[model samples]
Target: MTDADAQTAPDADVTQLEELSVTANRVDGPQAAVGSAISSISGEELEQRQIRVVSDVLRELPGVAVNRTGPAGAATAVRIRGSEANQTLVIVDGIRVNDPGTSGEFDFANLLNLEVERVDVLRGPQSALYGSDAIGGVINIVTRKGEPGPPRFRASIEGGSFKTMTGTASVSGGTEAYDFLFAGQGFSTRGVSTASRFDAVVPTRSLDHDGYKSGTGLAKVSVRPTEALEFTGVARYTEFDADRDGFGATSDGYPFAAAVDNRDTEKGKQFFGRAQAKATLLGGAWDHILGLSYTNQDRRSFAGTDLKTYASLGEMTRFDYQTNVRFETQGALPASHVLTFGADHTRDAVKSFTAFPFPADAPNPLRKHIDNAALVGQYQIGFFEKLFVTGSVRRDFNDRFEEATTYRFASAYTFDQTKTKIRGSWGTGVKNPTTFELFGFSGNYVPNSDLKPERGEGWDVGVDQPIWDDRIVIDATYFQQRVRDLISSETVPDPGDPTGFVNRPINLAGTSKIDGVELGLTLKPINGLTLRSAYTFTDGQDATGATLVRRPTHIASFNANYAFLDDRANVNLGVIYNGRQRDLAYDAATFARTSVPLKAYTLISLAASYKLHQNAEIYGRVENLFDKNYEEVLTYNTPGRTAYGGLKVSF
Candidate 1:
C-alpha cells in the first residue's frame, strides 16, 4: 500500500501472484511486466489502517513527499521524486481531476476515501501516454465496480478527539447484463490553530482553532449485453469548507500576504464524469475503446465577512480513442507481439477574481482557454514468456505557445532460478505553464504570458526479489532526473505603480538536478502476521546548488499488522521518520524571506479492529502517539496526539 504492504502467503502458487497496473500503460497489465516503479494500496488496507484521507498514508511511500500547510483540511501538496507538485498527474478512474484554475495541480486536502477499490502510484515520467502535467509521475484511484451478485449495503460512523465526526454509506448490486453502485461520505473536524505560537506576527499564543467540513458522492454503472460489446460510466462530486490562517500582517495590518491569525476560510466544489464503450472484433485479435470525460471545479476564499475575497472556476472536456492489436501463438515457449495506439483532445478554460486589499484595482478581469491534442503509439514484445520490452512515443499539438514530443523505453526480465525480476525505464517529459502562472492571479502578481514550458528527462533501474516461498519480498530502485527552464517566483518593481512591487514567475537560467534511492521490504514471518518497511534518500538542488525547499533528504517508515483470536480481531502499528528539511520563512519584522532549517521528526499511530458479529465490527485508532510538535510547512502548527473510535456494519 504505502510501500510494500505485507500479505500472508496465498494457497495458490507463490510465483504466480501478480498485481495488475493500468496507469503505467494505457491498458491493464501485470505490474511486473511494466519495467517501471509502481505500487498499489487495496481497500482492505484503507480499512485496516483506519485511513480516511489519502494523504495520511502517502508519507510511507518512496519517492514521495507530503506537505500540509496546517491541520487536516489545510492546503496539501504532494511531490514525487523531488519534482514540483504540479508536475504530477492525478486521475480518478479514466477522468483527469487536476484543477486547471489553481496552478494546474490537484489539491489532496478535500479528497475522501469513498468507494475506492484500489490506489495505484506510478513513479516515472509518463508523457508518452498521458499528454501534459505528468512530468513527475501519476496517481490513479480506481473505484469499486459491481460484480454479478446479490444486493449489498454497508454503513459506518466514527467520532474522535478534536470534535471530529465521519460517516459513510454505500449500496451496490448487479446482474448478468448490468451492474450499478452508489456511495456517499461526510467528514467534519475542529482542528488546531494553524499559525505557530513561535511566530512573531501571531496576535496571541491562543487563537481560535481552525475547522473543516466536507461531503462527497459517487455513482457507477456498467452494461454488457453481448460478449463483444460493453459500456461503462462513472460520476463523482465533492464539496468542502475549510478554515485557514492569514499570511503575516502587513505594515498597515490586515496581512494581504501569513503567520498572523485570522478568520479566513476556503470553500470548493468539484465534479467529474466519464463514459466509455469498448468493442472486441476479429476474433479477439482487435480491441477498440472510445471515451469522453468532463471536469468542473469552483473554489472560493473568504476573509472574515468578505465571502469572495478570492474565487476561481475551472473546467475541462476531453475525448479519447484507442485501439490494440495482438498476435500470439500457443506453444511451450510462446512469443507474442502487441501494438497499441491512441489519440486524445482536451479543452481547458478558467476564470478567476481576486478582491483582496484592492477590490477595484484587483479582481483580474480576463478569462483564458487552452486546447491540446496528442497522438501516442506503443509496441510491446515478449519472448520465452519471461522477458518483456515496451517502447512508446507521443507528439502533442497545442493552441498555446508550446508543442512537444516525448519518448519512453522500458524492459523487464525474470530469472526462473531465483524468481527475481530486473527492470529499467527511461523517459522524456514536458509540462506547460499553468493558466495561473501565465495570466496571473491578481494585480499584485504580474503575468508571465511569454513564459515557456518546463522540459525534463529521467531514468530508473530496479530489482524485485521474492524469497522464502513468497513470504518475503525486497525491492530497490535508483533514479535520476534533470529539469530545464524551471519556473520560480521573483519580486519585481511594478513599472506602472512605482512605489509597489509585484511577484512574477520567471524561468531560471540553469537546470535543476534530482536523484534518489528507494528501498522496500515486506515479510510474512508467520500466519496472520505481517511486517513492512521502506526507506528513501533524495538529493535535490537548484542550478545554484541550494537544496530545494521542503525536499527532505532522508525518510523511513515501518508497519506491522497482526491478526489473532481466530481472525476475529486485528491490529496495526505504523512508525514514520522524516529527516531534516529546508523551508522558506518570512521574518515578521523585516518581511524578508529566508531559508530555514526544520528539525527531523517521527510519528507513530496504532489501530485495532474487532469483529462483533458476522456483519458488524468496531474499530479505534490513536494518531500522533507521542504528541510530536513539528511542522510540514514553516509557521504551520501540526496536530498533536488524538484518538477516535467507530462501528461498521455490512450485509
Candidate 2:
C-alpha cells in the first residue's frame, strides 16, 4: 500500500481520532498541546483560488506580506512581523532548502503548483523543533504521491493580460506494491509596462522589457514489500528566468547601472526516502519513522550596468543528508502521557562565485563546509479532565558555529465540557547569519566574523469557542515577540577610496518588538452557504521608537461561498484590504520621501465552478474585478484585472 492508503488505515485498538499534522511530532488537532501556531490549506482551495505560486497563497494570512521585484518569475521575498526574508524557514517533506551562503530567501516562482498536495504554515518560534532559519516561521510543502489504480492525468492552460500564459500537467499510476506520480508546469509573462506609470517617455524603449519565464517538475515513487514495512522516495526540480531593469536610483538619474542580463535564476533538486515498521509488545505498539533526505541548489544572479549592462553573477551550492528516528509510546499512562525522542544530523558544503563586468581577477571565490547535529525530547501530559501541558527542548551543535539550546512550553485548558478552549505557548528562536553576510568580498562591503546568533522570544495566547450548534467557530489570539542582536550595515568614511564608502555589520540597537492580535471566524449559516473572515492588527518597532519597515499595521480578509443549483455548482467571492506602512531609509541624501505610504486598495475576486461529471469539474475566476491601481512599493506597480478558467479531473 502507498502512503495515502496507509494513512487511511487505522488500528482498531486505538480509540483516538486520526489526527493530521505536520508541525508537531504527533499528528493531532490544532488545539492539542503544542508549542506552535500551525495553519493548513487544502488542495481544493489551492485550485479554487488559482494560486500559481506559494507566496500568493501565503499573503492571504494575517501579518504576512510578499514583495516581488516584478513579473511572475522575478525575485520575490516575504516579510513576517517585520522580520527579514531569510528569518523564515522553507521545507519540503522534512527537507530544508535554505541556502547557507546567501541572505536571499527561497522564491516560490520556481515551484510547480500542480505537484503541491497541501501546505502547512507553522508560525512563531520553532527553534526547538527545527534548528536555524526558524525564527519567524516555517512553511512546509507536501507534494502529491500515489494514485489508486489505473493511470490518472490532468492538464490546465490559462492566459491573461500582459501576455501571460501558463500550463501544467500531472500523471500518476500504480499497483498494489508500487506507485508513482509526476507533474510539471511552465509559465511566461510580458510583465507590466513600468513606463506607463513613470515620468519617462520612449518609442519602444519601454521599461516594460521586464518579462519572465519559469519551469518546474516533480516526481515521487513508493513501494511496500509487506504489511508492516514500507518505503517512499520523492524528487523535484525548478528553474526561473527574468529580465528586469537594474535597481538604479532613478529612471534617468545618471544611468548608475545598465541592465546586464538581469536574470534571477535558480535550480534545486531534492530526494528523500523513508522506511517504517510496526510491531506490538506488552499491550502497546511501536511505529517507527526513519528517513534520509538530501538536497542541492544552484543559483545565478546579476546586476544591470552603465552602458550595455554588465553582469555580476553569484552562485551557491548546498548538499544535505539527515537521518530521523522517532519513537512514541502507544498506551503510556492511559494514552494521556506521551513522550517522543529524535536525533538529527546534517552536513553542508558551500561554494560562492562572483563575476564583475570590468574585472577579470577581482577576487577569488570562497569555499566552506558546515555540519550540524541535534537531539530533542518532548512530553505531553493531561493533568486532569480539563487541563493539559506540553514541554520540549533541543540542543544543537554546528561545526562552523557555536552551540545553542532552544526550548518551548505550552498549556491548554478546557471549560464547559470542551465547548471552549484556551491555550498559550512560549518559545525561543535562534538564527545563524548566512555565509554571504559573514564572508563575502570586502571592497565597499565588509564581512564581520565577530557576529553572534540572533535570538528571539515570544508567546501567543488564544481562545477558541463553538457557537450556534457548532455551526460557527470563532478564535482570537494575541502574540508578542522580542529579538536581540539584530544585524545591519554601518557606513564609515574610506581613506583610500575615491567616493569614500565602507559598510560593515553592526549589532545595532538591543531589541526589536512586535505585538499583534488576530481574529478569525467561520460561519455556516444555512445548508449551502459558508463564510470565513480574518483580521489582524499589528505594531512593530524598536527601542528607538522607529517603526520597522515594510510591516503593515492592519490586514483584513473575507471569503463567502454559496452553492447554487444543487451542491454541484457554486460561486465564491473574496475581498482583501491592506493598510499603508512606513519605509526605512538606507542613507542620508537618498530619502525620496518622508514616508512611502502605500495607498489602501481592495482586491475583489470571483470564482465559479461546475461539476461536468462525477470526477471532473470546470472553474473560472476574474481577479482584481475593478482593475484597481496599487503599489506595494515606491515605484513598482502590480498587475491589473485578469481572468482565467480551467478544468480539474480527479479519479
Candidate 3:
C-alpha cells in the first residue's frame, strides 16, 4: 500500500477501500486487502462538518457514541461496542496518549480538530497490533505531514452563537532533504449554565456560567540525509481551561447531573514529541526502524469554595516514554513471506492529589511508577496468490506486578482476483488500574493495591464484497470479547450507619462479554454522488447476565454527498440514530432494580460548501436540522437546532 493506492483506488468500491485501508494496520489499499471492520473519515469531511472537536468528527461513525459530560475542554468519554471508556486505546501519531493518572483515559473534550489529517477506527479487539487498553479496539488519529512541494500558507477566522470565536493558521513546505509543517488553532465560547435533572435536594438551576478556552499547536520536520537514512520528528502541545459548577440530589439518592456549572477552573496541558529513524541493514534485505517518544500531561482544578465534602481541588500528572525497534525482512522464505521482530520498552509514572475534609485537612497525593519491557514478533505468509496467514506473539514484563503474555492468529482469503475477501483474528488484551482507582482522598472508600489487570480475549470475522459492476460494496463483520477479572467500584454497607455506605474498587467474580455485528454499504448511484451507510448491533452482558449501562444495543449512521456545479460545490446530508440504553443505577446497594430506560433518538444534519476560488471556500451546517432534542448522556441534554458556518483557504 502506497500513496498512489490511496489516491487512485477503483472508483467502483471506493468506500470499501477506505474501510480496508484504515482497519489493516495503516495499510493503504482496498477492502480485498484488509481483514477487519474499519472506518475512515477524511479531512474534507471534517471541514464540512465545521466541527471543533474530535467528538464532533466521531459522530459520523456508526457504533461509536460520545458523551459530552461538560463544556469544551472538560470531561468527555467515548464508548465503542458497549465497552468502558478505559478499554480503548487512543493513539496519536502511533503513540499512546491515554493519561495514566486519570484511569489511563484521556478526556476527548480536550482534543482539537485543526491538526488532524485523518482518523482510523478499528472495530474490535486490536491487542494484536497495540497492547493493553485496546480491549475494545483502537481510534488512531493520524496528523498531517508536510507535502512535498513549494511553501504554502493559509489562515481563517469564524464567529458563531454564545459569542464564540475561532481562528486557525497553517504553513507547510518541503524539499528533497527536509520538510517542515506547522499549524495552530484557538477556540473560545460562553457555555451554557448547569442544571440538575430530576433532582429535588439541589437547586434545579445554577447561576454558574461555564465556558472554556483552548489552544493547540503542531510541528513536524523530517530530515533525509541519504536514501538509506531518514529521520522524522513531530511534536504537539495543547492547553485549556474549563469552568464547572456543582452537583445535584434526587429522591433515589445522590445523583450527579451529567452537566453542571462550576466555580472551579480546570486547567491542563499535553505535550508529545517523537523521533524515528529507519535504516537499511543486512545488505538492504533487512529494514529497521528505531523510534523514541515522550508524552506528559498535567491537570488541576481549583475550586472557589471549600469543596472538601462534595468536591475536591484535584491535580493529576502523568509521564510516559517509549522506545521501539523493529527489523523487517521481505521475501524471507519466498516472494510473499515477511517477518518482523521488535522490542518495546515503556516507563509510566503518575501522581494524583486531592483535597478532602475532616481528618484529611490537607490535600493527599498518591504516586506510582512502572516500567515494562516486551519482546514481540509477527510474520505474514501468502499462499498461491489468493490466501494469507499472519501470526504474532508478545511477552510483557512489569516491575510493579506480574508478567503477562498474549498472542494473535489470523487468516485471509480472497476471490475474484482479490475483489472479495474474508478474514478472522483472535487476540488478547489487558488494562492496568489507574492511580485514582487505587488511592485517593480517604472517605468511605479503601485502596486496593492487589488489584490485577483486567484481561480480555476476543475474535473478529468479516467479509467484504463488490456487487453490480463493483459500484456497490458491502461489508459485514461479527465480533465477541470476554473480559475477566474486571475491576469496578462497589458499594458496601456502612457499619456505623445502616443506610450509609462505602465504595471500593474490587475484582469482579467473573467475566463480562461483548458481542456485536457491523454492516456497511457504499453505493455510487451515478457519477458525483455517493451514499454510505453503516449499522451496528451490540449485546453486552456481565457474568450476572445484566445489560451494560450507558451502552445502546443498536446504533446507525448514514451520509450522502454530492459534488455538483462542475465539481466546485458540494452538498452532504447525514443521519444518526442511537437505540435505547440501560439507564443509570439509582440504587447500587440492591442491584436488583432494573435500569431506567434511555429513549431512542435520531438526528439529521445538512452541509453545503462552495468554492470561491481554487484556494478558498465557504461552508455552513444546520445541525439537529429538525431541532430534535436528544441526549448522548442521560439527563444532560445535547444542543438543539444549532447552526454554524465557517471559511477555509489553502495555498
Candidate 4:
C-alpha cells in the first residue's frame, strides 16, 4: 500500500521562503519581489545555536568568509564573494560603524549578540542605495523592539575553558503611548598566544598568553502618540581592552619571528546612537522616515606595562531622509508600482599622534576632516503576480574626489504552476580613499592626495527549485565581478636624503577579477529533523594572472538539527571545511615577503538544550569537538575543544 503512494508522490523540495522581508536596501519588499542575492537569519536560530558572535553566523553563509587574526576580541574581518574585507558595509541600528581614521574597514570583534531580532545580508555591489564602501555587500542588524506587554526581565551567566566568563541582563516593556528597553553585557577571556610556537625561529621559547575584556550598555525608547506617527531613539556604548604579542627581540633570543612575551596593549571605546521619526500618510499610500546617527571610536596603543602614549580618534555624523509612494490599479488582477527617494549627508574627522618620545611624536597633531553628500532614487513594478522589476540610481559628491554616479537593475519571475523563482541583478560600486590614505600618517610612508576612488561592477543570476512536495529545496547562483584603480605603495626618490627611496601610495593600472558559484540545499525529511548544506567555488585573480591571497577555491558546510522529548529537548550538529589557500610570509632577516600555502582543515560542533519549565531552560555546547589543530591566519592559534554550560530564566 505504501510503495504505490511513495512512487506517485509530488517531489517538491521546498517550503515558503520568499515570504520573508528584504531590509538590506532603502526599498523594502517581499524577498520574492526583489532580484538580489539575499538571506535572513532569525533570532530563534541564534538562540538555539548560542552563537554569541555575529561573524560565526556569517561563516556558514553561501558566499561569505570570516577570519580573525587570533582569539576572541581580536581583529576580525568578513569578506563576501571574493571581495576585500574593507569593501563590505556593516550597519547597526542605522548607524555606520566603519573606522574612518584607518583603512575604513569595520572590525567585527567585540560585537556581542544582544537583543538582535534578525540579520539581513545582501550580496553584491550596492553603492546605488548605500553609497561608498558597499562594493562587496551589506549587513544589517535589526534589534528587538518593545511591543504592548507587561515588564519582562532576562539574565544569564556562563563560564568555560580559557578562563572565559560572560553575562548579560535586560529589561523591556511597552504601553500604548510609550516603550522602553535597557540592557548590559560583560565578557572576559584569558586567550592563547597570538604568536604561535610554529611561527617562532626558536621553537623552545615559551610564549605568554594574551587576554581580552569588554563591557557594553544599551538603551532604547520610543513614543507613539498616534497610530500613523512614531519617534524612536537608540544609544549603545562598548569598551574593550586587548593584550597582544608581536615580532621582536626577547630575553632568550634575537631576531625572533614571534615574540615570546611582550607587554603591548590596545584599548578602544566606541559609541553609536541614532534618532528617527517615521510617518505613514496619504491614506496608507505614502511612508517617510527622517533620521540622524553618530558614531565615535577612540583607540590607544601602549608598548609597556606602564601604559605610556600613542592614541588615535575618529568621529562620524550622518543625516538621512527617505520617502516611498505606492500606486495600485483597480482590476480583478491588480498591478502595483512603487517609487522611493532618499538623501544622505556625512562628515568625518580623525587625528592620530605618538607621545612616547620618538620620531613619531606629534604633540600638536594634524587633524583632518571631510564631507560627502549623496542622492538616490528607486522604482519598482509588478504585473500578473509573477513578474517583478526594479531600477536604482545614485549620485555622490565628495570633498576630495570627483563626482560619482552609480546604478543597479534587477528582475525576477516566478512560475505559477511549480512556484520556481528565477532572479538576476547587475550593479556598480565606488569607494573613496580614507582620511589616513589621503593626508594622514608620517615617517617611512607618504600620503597621496591625488589618488582616485576605487571602482567596481558585478552581476549574478540564480534559480530556486523545490522537490518532494516542499520537503527539500535547492538554490544555486553564479556571480562575477571586476575592480580597478586599486591602491598600492611604490618607491619614490627621497626628498631629504640622497641615494635612498621612500614609499608613496599610488593607484595601480591593473584590475582584479572574481568569479564564483554558490549552491545550497535544505531537507526536512521527518518531524523535528532538519538538514542543510552549502558549497562555494571561487576563482579570484589579479591582472597579472596570479591567484588572490587568502581566498579558498573550495568551501563547504553541513548542519543537522532535531528536536526530541516532546519538543522540550533539542540537539544540533555542524561541520565546516575550508580548502587550502595562499598567504604571504615576511622574512625577519631580510624583510622580504613570499607566498606560502596554508593547509586545509575541518571543524565540528555539537549542542543540546532542555527546558525545565515554561520560563526556565538549561543548555550547553562543545566547540571544536575533534580538537582539530588548524590555523585560519598564518601564525595565530585558534581555540580547541571548548565547552560551556548556562541557565536561562525569564519572567
> What TM-score does candidate 1 get on C-alpha atoms?
0.93
lDDT for 112 (candidate 3): 82
RMSD in Å for model 2 = 5.2
Residue 168 of model 4, lDDT score = 89
Give the per-residue lDDT of model 2 (tens digit) for 315-434.
Answer: 322222222232333553433665656666766555566553112343456665556787777777664445667787878887777889998787777676656878788888888766
Q: Which candidate model has the greater TM-score, 3 or 4?
A: 4
Q: What's the candidate order when arranged by decreasing TM-score?
A: 1, 4, 3, 2
lDDT of each: 0.80, 0.62, 0.68, 0.77
Please provide, for model 3 over 144-256, each residue's C-alpha lDDT reduced to its tens digit, 9 standing for 90 to 100: 77878898998877776656778899999898888888999999887655333433444334345567888999898889898777677778888887776544344344533
Model 4 lDDT, residue 146, Cα: 70
TM-score of 3: 0.88
* Top-lDDT structure, candidate number: 1
Each prediction's TM-score versus the true structure: 0.93, 0.85, 0.88, 0.92
Highest-TM-score candidate: 1
lDDT of 1 by residue, 1-651 (tens): 000010110111112125533445555444445687876667777778888888777787778888999888888998889889989888887788888887898889988788777666678888887768888888777778777799899999999999999999999999988999999999999988887542244455457789999999999988988988888888999999888877755333432234557788889999999888878889878878888889999988887746678788889889888887888867797878878888888888888888753324544655888899888889888887678889999999999865799998988888999989898999988888888888746635667888898888899999988999989988899999888888877776666666666677888878999999998888999999988888989999987788899989998989898999998999999999999999886544334456788889999999999999989999999999999999898767899999999999999
Question: Against the hidden true structure, what lDDT does model 2 obtain?
Answer: 0.62
